[model samples]
Target: MGRVLFVTPPLTGHVNPAVGVAAALTARGHQVAWAGRPEIIRRLAGDGADVFPCAVPRRLPERDASLKGPAAFRFLWEEFLIPLAEAMAPGVRAAIGRFRPQVVVADQQAIAGGLVADGLGLPWITSATTSAELVDRLAGTPKVAAWLDELLDGLRSRIDGGPADPRMSPHGVLAFTTRELLGPATVPHQVRLVGPSIGGRAPTCDFPWDRLDPAVPTVFVTLGTTNADAAGDFLRAAARGLSRIDGIRTVIADPGRAVGPMGDTVLVVPHVPQMAVLARVDAVVCHGGYNTVCESLWHGVPLVVAPIRDDQPIVAGQVVDAGAGVRLRFGRAKPDRIAAAVTRVLDDPGYRSAAEKVGASFRAAGGAAAAADHLEALLSG
Candidate 1:
């Protein structure tokens, strides 16, 4: 049995998918372990998961909500990704020495895994929790892409590693999306569009399941984990907009407690069992986080996507291009616009049809099982 080590960041979206893949590997009689933030890995992968501790910045101050476009991209790489890679380099190396796995499954955002593994002459595969990087969002912006290359070069030098693109592994990439959503975007040969790794996440907080009314149209609204600070206004707008429509229930995830109070018709909470809720909802309204968008589509639920920053616009574009949802301006969307988008998605059957089509493709792509198959192939090859 091959020993597989998954190296992920502390982010829930990234780790959640890896959890599913690791579980698949374990079920196949292969040994699997994790190297990341122990607290988060344990929470999402269950306390029994074999995990090695890693260090993150003591305090990662939230990004300015107004930052967008190129600025946001630069900030993500410089402020978060680079620092995170550097901070994690030692832990990743130590984990490699201790766990001594034959293969490493590295989260695209967690470059340290690739860098450290490359330095130690071990094979690594990218666990692409999101499909944004796989399609090359920077293809049009040569200068921006060049700038990023330089930054990565500097990061590699700091970690004393040879040249290599940490984002894409030469061995393989387990992309959590498929061509159905990606449209005609040119994908690299090494990428395996294995669909979203949906299950195997340790159960999260409970929801008020009884509050959901099957008679009324239900819309699940969320901005995902990282965007809570920027989500307050959008969540309020969504609630107001959904309220304007009669016989519609809105379930909003307000992780930051941005929304104060709401009536029984609108359920506001700090968090929701997202996957469980998606199964019951008629529609979704979200910030277009790839994971959330993919999960919603997995359940054949249409969406109203308001993209904020960092691959969200690219993901939102895919959703619109696929005819699965409507896009709204994150900052300028008022209640009327929000309501209008939701109304269009909820009333029009075409959106749901598109989402169901995408969902069908996802199921056929084999999800985590296919991802594990590819991993085993890598070892055999």
Candidate 2:
């Protein structure tokens, strides 16, 4: 039996997909463990999970809409991603020594895991949580791209423990998104598009399932777990939008207390059993987080995507381009405009059909189990 080590960032979206794949590996009689912040890993992976502690930098609230294009990319890599890699490398190396895994599965965002594993002469796979790598927009800007390349080189120079390794591993890469939704692209031969690795997510909140009315169509609205502060006004606008509609109910996951005073038409809660809600909802209104969009589309639910920052605009564009949803301006979207968009998606069968088509692709792409098969194959070879 092969022992697989999952090195991930502390963020929930990055860690969740690996959880599913890890579960599949465990079921196949392989030993599985994680290296990241203990609190996050434990909460998602369970208390009994073999977790190697890694120090994570405290991320301050970031909702800077002013930082655009190359500047945003630089800020993300320099301020967050690179720092995370450097902080995690020591722990990753230590875990490699102790856990003695056959392979390392590093999240696409957790660059240190791949770098350190390369240093240790171990085979590692890139666990891409999103499809952005296949079609990165930064490739268009020569100066910015060259600067970013130099930045990565500098990171590797300072932190490189051994021979050079591509930031994305050449051995194998597990992409959780299917090409059907992301469209045609130049994907490496080693990269496997294994759909969304949505395993049994341990529910954080006990949802009021009884509160949901079957008579009315419901829209599940969320900004995911991370963007509470940035999405406050938008969430409030969505709540108001849904509230004004007749014979429709909306469930808003208000983790940051963003929405105030909900009526019978709107249910405001700190956390929701998102999978459960997704199963029952007619449509989704969310910031274009890849996980939420994919999960929603996986359930054949259409979306009204309001992009905020980072890869969200790209994700929103994908949603619109795929005809699976409507895209709205985050800061500029008024309650009336949100309501109209939601109405359009709900009323139009075309959007629903498009969402179902994407959902079918996701289902056929063979999620976690297929990902496990791919990983196991890499080890065998």
Candidate 3:
């Protein structure tokens, strides 16, 4: 049995996909451990998970909510990704020394895992939780692409890594999405479309099941874990919009406490048992976070995607292109627009049909088990 180490960032979206793959590896009699924040790994992966602690920034860099497009992209790499890799390099090296695994599974955002593993000549797999980069958003912008390349080169120099992009491993890339959502984007041979690693998450919240009215159409509203700061107005707007519609009920995951009080038709909580909620919801109103979008589609539910900064715009566009959802502007979307989008997705069977088709493709792609199979092949090859 091969020993595998999962290197992940503290972000929930990145770590969640790896959890299912790790479980699958363990089930196959292989040893699995994680290199990331112990609290996050343990919370998501479980209490029994062997976790090697990595250093994260003292505080996440604060960015203006107004930053978008190229500016947002630059801010992410400069303030977050670069600083994160620098902070985590030492700890990743330490984990490698102590664990001495045959292969490392690194999250796409956790650059240190790939850098340290590549430096040590260990085979590392890239776990792409989102399909944003696979489509190449920077294709036309040569200057931006060059700038990113130079930035990565500097980071590589600091970590003593080889001249390779950490985001795409030479060994393999486990993309948690199918071609159904990616459209005509060109992907490399090393990338495997393993779909969403859907299972093996331990629920973190106790949802009020009895409060849900099965008599009416239910919409699940969330902006995911990281967007609490910027989700206030959008969340409030969504709640207000969803509340006005007749025969429609909504469960809003208000982690930011953005939407204060609502009527009998709306249920607001800090967190939700997402998978459970998705199963029953008629539609989803989200910030186009990849995990949420994929999960919603995985359950054959449609969405109204209001994309925020970072990779969200790309993901939201993909949702629209796939015919699985409607898109709204995150900053500029008004209540009426939000309501109309949700209503359209709920009423029109085409959105649901498209979502179901995508969901079918996701299941056929073999998800976590397929990802594990690829990892095992990498070790044997």
Candidate 4:
């Protein structure tokens, strides 16, 4: 059995997928160690994998918090990334040396993993939570492109004495999204579409599968764990949109205190087992994160995606094109428009049928087991 070191972002979205891969590795008798935050470390430990804490800033000070908008974006670039990267570099290097891993699997956010792997002359794999091309595509835009260039330049400067070009990094990229979602692009030879690594032991909670009335079509609303604040607004808008629908029950999973009171048809809960819930729902209203999209597709549930930020737009666009979902402009969204979209999705049977086909394909891909097999092959090679 080979020693594998998995590095992930502090956020749950990134950590959860990595944990899935780690669990698979451990099951296969390979030694798996993860470097992440304390909470994630605990979760990884629970999965029977050794955990190492990556010394990145897991929480921001209350005084330093900025409301989401242009200000948040600016703060992320200027205040967050610069300092966080600097502080994290030593921890990444130390972990790599101490673990002496045969292979390093890292999230895209932890660019330091790639740098450390390169310096140590070890094999490195890049795992993406969303579409792999998200950063590159965003950087290609005319206005925001410059900022992306500067960010890359800054990362390069931190790595080497002088600014290092991003193209010089030699690491294999593994996208956790499907080809249908990522679209066709001339990705690097090292880049591979490994499908979504979303495996986990079934939740302890007793999901109310029996209570779901199949006669009345159901829509599951989830904003994901990280961006629950944005999801709350969507739930309110969707509640208004679905209010008039006679036989539709909307289930909103709001773990982040974003969801509020809705009509009789809408059920608000702190959290629900996503896959279990998706299994019972006819459709999903989501933020279009790769994990959620893949879960929805895996369950054959059609989608109404309101992409709030980041790679959400890309995922939303792919689902829409595949005839499995509808992508709405989040900025201009209102209750009526959202309702109309939901109506269109539910009224048509084709969307659900198409989604089921994709779900079958996703299931056949073998999820994290396949991913582990690939990593094992890489380690041996």
Q: Among these predicted structures, which one has the highest lDDT?
A: 3
Q: Write the per-residue lDDT of candidate 3 for residues 145-246, one digit (tens) a residue.
A: 999999999999988876667999999899999999988889988999999998887778799899888888999999999987798888899888889999
What TM-score does model 1 achieve against the real structure? 0.98
Tell me model 4's lDDT, rounded to 2 decimals. Answer: 0.72
TM-score, candidate 2, is 0.96
Worst 10 residues of 3 by lDDT: 130-139
lDDT (Cα atoms) of all candidates against the true structure = 0.90, 0.86, 0.91, 0.72
Candidate with more favorable, higher lDDT: 2 or 3: 3
lDDT per residue (tens digit) for residues 1-381 in model 1: 899999999899899989889999999999999999999999898989998888887777589999998888899998999999998988898888999999999999999998888877899999888878887778899999999999989988898764668888888989999889988878899999999998998888988889998888898999999887698888998888888789899999998998877788899999898999999999999998988999999999999999999889989999999999999999888999999999999989999999999999999999999999999997776
Candidate 3 lands at a TM-score of: 0.98
Candidate 3 local distance difference test against the native: 0.91
Kindly list the per-residue Cα lDDT of model 4 for residues 1-381, writing each as its tens digit. Answer: 998888766666777678678888988899888776657656534645566666766565332312444555566556665555556677777787788899988777666666667666778777777773534564445677687668767675676422322223345666676666556655666666677776654353455465568788898888787774455566777777777778899887777666577767888777787767887888888878778898888888899998876556667888988889998877566888888888888899999998987777666666687778788888889
Candidate 2 lowest-lDDT run of ten: 159-168
Per-residue lDDT value at 379 in model 4? 86
**What pairs collide in candidate 3?**
none
Better of 1 and 2 by TM-score: 1
State the local distance difference test value for candidate 2: 0.86
Residue pairs clashing in model 2 are: 176-195
Which parts of model 4 have CA positions greater than 4 angstroms off? Answer: 44-47, 58-79, 132-135, 138-150, 156-169, 201-211
